[model samples]
Target: MKKLLIILLVLTGTTAIKAQTRTADESAIEKTWARFGNSWRNQNFSDMKDYMTPDCHWINVVGMHWRNLKEVQFAHQAFITAFLKDAKAVDKSSNLRFLTNDVAIMYRVTHIGAFYPPDGIDHGTNKQGDKDNIATIVFVRQNGKWLIASGHNSDVVAQAAASDPVLHMNK
Candidate 1:
């Protein structure tokens, strides 16, 4: 009986250690997301660039795609230069899944509001739409830091319906 109790205690202790380690990893990944949001709100495109890998890719709600880091950087720089003079964003992490110790997928919601210069290019159309959307970001730990590997952004309602069975009850 004493031997069985010791074995059980060891198993529980191992589980507790794993849980703590997993929580630490999640917190670190969350910080990466927070940094991405801060970049948008603070207009720090350099930080944004740093958060992504060289071959990182992204597809937006409008079907616009950025295929690589350079392309993403160029687009972000253009927006910052020509618009987004008064841009604000709040990013919240909604869900996370770890595929491996080095890879994670995160779902988040971002609310963005922007005011473009009156004479700026594409001023007639609010390019960002100043609304909330859902984003899925794939992060891979490279050389000890988390960086975005790929991402997709789309309408919140659509994503929620697809992800939540409770929301899809009728259809």
Candidate 2:
């Protein structure tokens, strides 16, 4: 019985240690995300270019597709200048899944705050007054640094019908 007890303790300790540890890749990815968030808040798309691959693809919340890094930088700069100059991006939560040692996908929920329409334009807001979007970004490690390869952002909408049993069980 004493031997069994010792084995169980050892197993538990191993599990706890593993749970508390994060790989270097995970730490690097987290830092990359922090830098991206900072760039967005600063409205510095030029700095953001360094984080993305030259052939990066991005799809915005409104369904506009940017096919390359140049397009992505240009569109973000224009949009921020015209409408979202004062908007701030707050990352609510994120989950990263690795497909390979060099490739990972991150799903992030971000809140856009301090939003206001430009010059008498009325872009209606939700009841919460702020907007939340979910972004799925693919990151690929190139030359020891992770770079954004592709991404898609979609507005998070609360729909009661989506939770209905009939719709959920359709699959």
Candidate 3:
């Protein structure tokens, strides 16, 4: 009985140590996501690529297609032309969950710098929009670096507002 108790105590201690290690890894993912968002707002796509896998996949809600890194960067040029005119991503929040020591998923909400018209018209040359979206990103850490494996963003404001009629009416 004493031997069994000793074995159980060792196992519990090991488990506690492992859990602490995993929490540290999960916390790093938050900083990784922050770097990604900042680089994007700065139009530093090249710098941003370090956060993404070479074959990273982007699922854009725009219904264009599932784009690879290069295509996404090219598309961003257009995005920059429209949104980056005087806009930025602000009020960001990142929530991360670890699938493993090397794999993580993040849910984030952030404001885009300007309001985009549905017809692809650029408005508010210097002014901004109240538009923001929520996104999900999958990150994989390989060879001591974290790379984005997949990501998707969806419009959340209108849907969230619609759910609360009083808030919508106030707006």
> Candidate 1 clashing pairs?
none
lDDT of 1 by residue, 122-163 (tens): 656645547777889999999888888898988665445668
Model 2 RMSD vs true structure:
5.2
Candidate 2 whole-model C-alpha lDDT, 0 to 1: 0.80
| Cα misplacement distance, residue 101 of candidate 3 (Å) | 4.0
Model 3 regions more than 4 Å off: 116-129, 159-171
Q: List clashing residue pairs in candidate 2.
A: none
Better structure of 2 and 3 per lDDT: 2
Candidate whose TM-score is highest:
1
Give lDDT: candidate 3, residue 152.
Answer: 89
lDDT tens digits by residue: candidate 2, 73-154 = 8988787775677677888999999898799999999987655544223467522216778999999999999889999998
Model 2 compared with the native: what TM-score? 0.75
Worst 10 residues of 1 by lDDT: 114-123
**Reference-based lDDT, residue 118, model 3:** 40
Give candidate 1 misplaced runs (Cα > 4 Å): 114-128, 157-171
Alpha-carbon TM-score of each model against the true structure: 0.78, 0.75, 0.75
